[model samples]
Target: MTQPPPPPPNQPPGPPPGDPQGGFGAPQDPPPGGFGAPTPPPQQPYGYPQQQPGQPQYGYPQQQPPTQPQYGYPQQPPTQPQYGYPQQQPPGQPPYGYPTQPQYAQTPPPSGGKKLSAQAQIIIAAVVAVALIVGGGIWYASSGGGEEKNDTAGATSGASQGKGGGNGVGGNGKEKAPANPQAKLAFQLPQPKVQDITDVSGSWLTDKAYVKTGVDSIVGYDLDKGAAAWTLALPGQVCGASRHVTADNKTAVLFEATKRVGPRFYQPCTEVGVIDLTAGKLVWSKSVTGGSAGDTKARFSEVTLSGTTVAAGGTDGGAAFDVANGNPRWSPKPNAQDCYDMGYGGGAGLVAARKCGPYDSQYVVIQNLNPLTGAPVSQFKMPPGVKYASIVSTKPLVVAADVGDTAGDGSGISDFFSIDEKTGKLKAKITADADRYAARCRSTEVESCTKVLVGNGRIYVPTEEHEGSSGEYGDETNEIVSFDLATGKPMTGKADAGDKYTLVPLRMDGGNLIAYKIPPYDKGGQVVSIDGGTMQATTLMENPSDDSVRDAENSFGTDYAEILYGNGRMFISDTMLSKPRASSSTKEYLALAFTTH
Candidate 1:
């Protein structure tokens, strides 16, 4: 009380007291949004005791719910900047409310009793000990603030860690599933047990695919390294064929030539598993069956060729087998049903689409046959439900899709006809938008007809809307159109559509058009690719419907175009023991190759 001058040990924080001109501390620029607005409750501190009508007072909870004028001095803002931005104000307060920083120039306390100056009373005891350490560091940071969902559930339940203004951290909770660019995404399928492993001659460049695994096995998915490099063990029984899909060198692994169908079973036919991506092995397998599997009127799916001579077509129809030894090398009198109908053909020879009603429905034949015996030598056509063929400008053309009937019940008017594989006739009949991508008839064969998609030269039908043409809204809308490759026609001139997308479980690629979405809990699938000369589509990946979306029709894409994509991976097959049976030339199938990236 009589000797007070012991203050100089460190002295850094100093600024308070009614000093006529001496406080200047830096951080004073606050008042603009600091302690602003809701601060009219101050003068009651002298005696501070007035709470009767509302008994529970100071501990606060009597009806204090209208908050949101916050900023008891900081800590607020955990992620609000979305709507056009600009609305954050709360330090010394006053952004849209005025005021501005470190202000307080209100000095006036030295009139009559003007006191000390040994440094002006040692600067009022260092400004009253720096306003008690700045009001005890603003009451220890507004007592660890509250309310914004218990400080965001205590910073995401990690028990408080992310400090600095607005905690609520991120990542470490494990969220991995976002990237899926896709170049072609393994053909988007899950419904194709075994549609030809190649041997009778669809000869897609050798591996031919399947080596055994109808119920499950003999897999192959390399889309640029996402995994499952190879799985060909054998013996379960479906089929294979992967000769030139792309992304690189292309590989095949076929097997199904055990003909005899009975007497201990054997006409499922086809077996040539070659791998050689650089010498992988299992390169030679040929069993093909004498008549090659054509007697009793015929039944082969496809295996075309003309140079090394392997031409097979079925329903007891197409033939020319001798890729060095499968032997028969000549057939068609059995009426190879016009070559190849429903799907798959272009291995170098067969075009197939023999519906033949309008005087041989545009004829579209393409059969130089005689690879050494298949013998037709010449039979070309192109405008009858064109054979679902692929191979741009290189010349091979055939397409066919129909649905016309004026409704006598044959699902009214729908069409597709492109021919001319070498003169059997009709070169180009691809109707503009072919009346809505047409398909819903009642009679027409190539396996009864309902799908057709050739490549870059253009052709991708799947439509239905003229059964009674319009009105009260209900054409059922199921389109997907395209055409126009060096003149087969229909790229839009009038069924005229672009970027419409929706084929239920549609498929077709030599560029891209995959489909299938919505079934049970969503097997997480959806693809897209449309660059057959910049038609440009591009959706490529959607995956994640779980457990491979119930095998989404065996996961399509032997060549839906852009070639191959990675991860968010795909492959699906179980076609009931390798489906492609004309009475069983060797059938047994199953395929799998999933992964969500």
Candidate 2:
């Protein structure tokens, strides 16, 4: 799901192929001395490469490269104010923030491909402006919030799995690795000056707090002194959250009922609430009107939490409530082949992704519901061009798609079936290869997806950062590999990420496999643990390459960040929040944490 870095050899040619405000075609403003100082590319170090005099540049330890451009996306001016993905833009582009071309065009790596780095094309233009303004779903459970139910073929029992396979409710719990861990920085959050591109996404981690989701409140912090400790506020603006908490820490969101006004700048995610992350509050909020596209209200874009239900979904459909007292339990009724649900994949059970016929033969069915009778106890149906799917794991029932679109790399995934929720059958498909995998899946957000990971019966995945046998200007690395959800093959072991680092996997910690790593640019991030069998990694916490904490951990770029290691800490946030680069003063952050104690 990363892709964009190819243009570098003589550069300057972008913006023609459908240049509706240019994305890969570069240029959208900020060049001629505006990014607050753009003269650093004469000899070596914007994205590094050009050292033949005596060669020899191996790994880490080479500091000295920051005379100005502190972190990314500055150099502005097309009137300058863009910030992206609030949803609904398509008319001549120009919205999703940062990527105004600061020289790229190195080209040359196609017959074997690998080159990429100017910090990976500024982290693939901030993950293509957060895959075009965040789509939805990405909760994966069982860090130990506990629900442990696996079996429609996921075959549970890797100490009771739950990280992308579900049911360990507000999950994330296996800490214990400490010995030498190393961490430091412990708290940082500042980056709120936003007036546009906002949606602070979400982030959790309980057993004392860490919450986050601010632009209309959720706060929480204080796990080891980051402070705040509780906020919850809300009246509008947290348009969706719910990576399924609830082993008591409860969880569910999706807001916006008012608050934007100037021509009503988007304010209809309806409402649907549930918070309570160990008492940080919210408890209940509701909004449903009718569904089947009728009384109007509905709106949601995604929300989950199984067992006690909650649900939510959108395109004007799917409802469900009762996380303890919001009550409804099911709504959105009208059906008759118009089929609407469109999103849902809560932990441990309850799947959905419906979207049936009509808009030009559109398909997508995948049911398996019954989280208190939303009905369909098993379905399937996707095939035929598949406009979208992405479930990733409803008890081994995985899904992900992009099929006929052939994963042109916007990463809705290019395949990963594995069904069998009792009898929906199928079981093993796999096929990844979106330029050698780095899993993604938000094409339309049926539970979003990222670096993928379904547990023990195997799925893992990582691979895409390439180029690293160490010198010639070496160091880029990446590797996790696993696949074998019953027999889609390849799985003898992998884990790597060493050289300049990049790993990412972040879940499943019973049979082991936690991962995070990123580092490089003078080093610091890590979290390791691997060994789901002997993939062997183990570091646990690391963080702190000093230089103001590696420039705030390289400005949270692991594809639109949010990361969240457990116990021995690690947090990192930012799901989009623009408005600081009037030509760089650097200093930006919305979340950060690290610990090791």
Candidate 3:
């Protein structure tokens, strides 16, 4: 049987390490200025680099998120109040009261329940104060509703923690001034030959793109112009199915399985191949058989690539290979506990969960290797009580841990910490107030939320929660929570999801954050950017393409909205058109790409 999805590279596969069965309870009153309360400006945590005097503070505005009109999605006035902001009009749309659209279904809460922050009273007071200050005037703008007058709600009242740039956003319900101009679409492209989009990655160094098409082909595209440069195909029949494919500027690694014919029963074989993009050829392919020689069908359950190391693991054990040449480098002993749930540490090398002592003693081990050779250069473990949860990278190696149960969100809290790559020493630690577990799961359904990314020296977390108390159609929350990359403290404010938008962060472009926004039950999605520092957002494109395309649905009825960032550009594609297409040349399966810079 396949092992449960391993937590990020250094993390294990299980409910958080501290308390597996605990239920996250209702949110408690935040400490001083915790979750909902207004507090002093954040003091840079230990190990955080000092900010320059003129550096911008990265935080989300306290005002509720707004909505927008998307391509094909008719412009509709928002009737219900957004999570933290009052209802407002979108740009280019007629004045409010056009016609009310049917409400979409509510996103079910986690099966164990959810904790709405207990800051409702404080929010009400702030809102009332803003209404009074504005004299209850209706401010309008061509871009959308007027800039949120109370955008800085509760940001500045707290005493300055240390020598910093400006007064924090007003804390005592005072309104802070608006920021950067509204966002506009930069550009959009179309992809017609795409049957389905499997993957998309960009390489800034080469200014090239690697994309997996629905039909067994990987194409390289030019970064400047949206054109295919080269295409590679997976040859031969593969037995097992795996989704652990990755690409850098120079090479792409794909995982597949093949069947070995036998006189009695056919046995399965695992294969990992590397495609040299520049040469436009399958450079190398290797078979993986980690278990005993007698066992004919030794297959891997997991596959991942870090640097040049491709690691594959099964319940029995795991192994590593050099992606440049399909040569075996190392394999774990049969049934060895250390080999269980092995994973590639993203750009970091090999990662494994090792049992150190006799029983009940297991430590997550990270091995930074030369990649050229499977030899470890160094290793480290998290401080005690901290269980390995997930990892992002190795240099200044980033990892998240399940620290234990916190007062609120009984699912327990996770800490994203960094380790010194040179010495394997602890460098910094930031506590994730919102549990990754709680964030990834809804009711009994579990989704991957470990895609947390770092950009422009800041860490970001995506959160989706019920916005206002009203169960209205459009008040649900979907935005990103940012933290100091060094300190791991939640930034002063957060990025808001637009009223007509349900944006999910894809990756970071330079210092800016890139995300895909899906309209409520709509076919197409939009590309938007959030200022890395201020958490302000701009819609790069509304519809992205003019052609109508219904979102694709899996057997599970889950909608597929594909948006990827790589090679210094954002790769976006639409699902197949819901209705029959007139011809294949139609842009039903095209990718709309834009240069982030």
Q: Pick the candidate with the highest TM-score.
A: 3
RMSD of every prediction: 35.3, 24.7, 18.3
Worst 10 residues of 3 by lDDT: 149-158
Ranked candidates (lDDT, high to low): 2, 3, 1
Which lDDT tens digits does candidate 1 get at residues 1-597? 011121122232122111011111000111121122212112221111111010000110011111221211011111111111111122332111111112111112345646344565445434533443354345334432111001000000101112121122111111123355422323322324434332221111112232122232344434433233456444424343422222222233345543233334344534443333322334344433323244443445433333344334444344444444454533344122232222123233433333222334433333322233222322333222342233211134443333222223242223333444433233343332232333332133222222344443455554533221243333233434444433442333112122222343233332333333222233344444333333334454555444533344334332121112222343443323223657754322233334444
The CA lDDT of each predicted structure is 0.30, 0.60, 0.38
Clash statistics: count for each candidate: 124, 17, 31
What is the alpha-carbon lDDT of model 2 when measured against the actual structure? Answer: 0.60
How does candidate 3 score on lDDT? 0.38
Q: Candidate 1's C-alpha lDDT? A: 0.30
Candidate 1, 95: how far from true, in Å?
A: 58
Local accuracy of candidate 2 as per-residue lDDT tens digits, 443-477: 78787676776766677778677776665464878
Error of model 3, residue 5, in angstroms: 30
